[model samples]
Target: MTNMSAAAAGPNATYNFKVVLLGEGCVGKTSLLLRYIEDKFNDKHLTTLQATFLNKKININGKRINLAIWDTAGQEKFHALGPIYYRNSNGAILVYDITDEDSFGKVKNWVKELRKMLGSEIVLIIAGNKIDLEHERTVPLEEAESYANMVGAKHFYTSAKLNQGVEELFLELTQEMVERFEQNSQTDLNRTQRVLVVDDEAPVQSSCCTGSKTN
Candidate 1:
């Protein structure tokens, strides 16, 4: 659970964090992850047997952050196994297909269970995936944004096919996680200055496909 600590030691420290993706089957959780981590997406739908794992590294404001991402099986049968993968997660990405209203409801369930287990210790990021199919969108932008706000989760629209909002989604999540982690352990002298600077940065806003952010 070391990585789940979200710890970044004194000077030149690297923040290590664990992230997991959860949602109903075929919600494009895998596709969105592929787009973020590998910058590749397969048009063909491939069923995930159990789970997939990947690592991503990014530098933010002179601080190094490493993310261990766990892509879990979205099948209902695997619902009981959710705790196994998300147990020590520092952050979670709950994805729901924009075309499937049921998937969005399921994401709410995941949020409940996650809060029961991890409380507010874990960061939450919700994504309304498949923006390319906006014409067929059943999930209203207002509803998604409202729900995200209600649950204290940042929301964004992502399209794996168009590679839209993918980078922004991850970047925002990473920045938020780093800020939270830094605040939790700001007792170190070296981190004091970094914390002050982070506090003055603009508050992250929900992003749309055009990279536009909302207040």
Candidate 2:
């Protein structure tokens, strides 16, 4: 629920989205986040204790959007708390290491949990990370992409070390969230208009009945 916008946002940022990062430990969830938000990468692996929050602002087309990203701990001990971070998220990035088949399986479990807890309305993206070590990859691109398609999620191969597809992934999710928000708003407006039309007709029908009775 914290807002993160650039100083230049001023009044242009009309859309705000809460995005959560989920993955197995050492899958580079934190690395991917840092690459997108800070544009920095470290070779050392550091385990997240609980969860970290970051706020970043970006412009999509002509509209400004703020992304509040939550990086959660990937350790098994913290698995039970995943809902605390992702519950009400506008979008989720489910990451897995390309070199680790086990991590990919973990990603699938996370997807199931998110869907069960947050429902299908949450925008999901499957990220096959550590693509920089493609030579050591155990999970094939075709396999990952196929799973993503089956689950109706976007798929991207990213390497936080090389800063590949990190920005594009976030931007795509942000745009999707904005489009969904606008669509929902329009639907509400249309429903209100329909109700008003019905109300207007009700009064006309009453007046017509009164006139007929007088005749």
Candidate 3:
């Protein structure tokens, strides 16, 4: 969906966008973010603090968009930390393990919490992960899709093990963020230029005073 590569944003320009990943424990949230950011997935089930950070870059519409992904712990113990990660996020991926009925059941709770803390402007994506283990699948595709539709989120089924649809799901979210940034950047550009002009003029005026005295 990103028409332009990140390289096109030039060597000096950097766009930082923030996104958060949420779901019940062992739903592959860390695996999905790791796979997307480093192209590697680990079997390790390390406990993340209230939140963990990951970074990645991609080209969209010929511009570089840098993603700051916050992977939060899904355990109930980390519930108080939810708002800490949700605030100021541009997008979110509500992940669930396809083989875990308990994880799937928590999707609505995650969404509701996010809405209460993060609000409606943030983009949301519903991700059903662990699709490679077809035999262990417990959540039906149609049901997940229906839930996503109800919440107006783009839905995806992925396998962190096989690396299926993991990148695709992230690309969709990045595309949405890039589109929003582009729309808002016109005003941002003008504001930046105005600040630049003011800074330069102040120095120029001081230099003119010294030059006039010398003459």
Quick one: best TM-score, which candidate? 2
| 115-156 per-residue lDDT for model 1 (tens digits) | 888888788999999999999999999999999999999999
Q: Report the error of model 2 at residue 102, Å.
A: 1.0
For lDDT, candidate 1 versus 3, the one ahead is: 1
- The lDDT values for all models are 0.87, 0.86, 0.81
Taking the tens digit of each residue's C-alpha lDDT, what string does model 2 give over 67-156? Answer: 889999999999999888987788999999999999999999989988887776788999999889999999988999999999989999
Off by over 4 Å in 1: 1-9, 187-215
- Model 1 C-alpha lDDT versus the unseen true structure: 0.87
Candidate 3 lDDT tens digits, 100-199: 9889889888888777765665789999998888798988888989989988789999988789999899999988876665555665678999999888
Better of 2 and 3 by lDDT: 2
Clashing pairs in 2: none
Cα lDDT for residue 180, candidate 3: 64
> Can you give the TM-score per candidate against the true fold?
0.83, 0.86, 0.77
Q: Count the backbone clashes (under 3 Å) in each candidate.
A: 0, 0, 4
Residue 22, model 3: Cα distance from true site in angstroms: 0.6
Show where candidate 3 strays beyond 4 Å: 1-13, 183-215
Deviation in Å, model 2, residue 179 alpha carbon: 1.2
* Residue 154 lDDT (model 3): 92
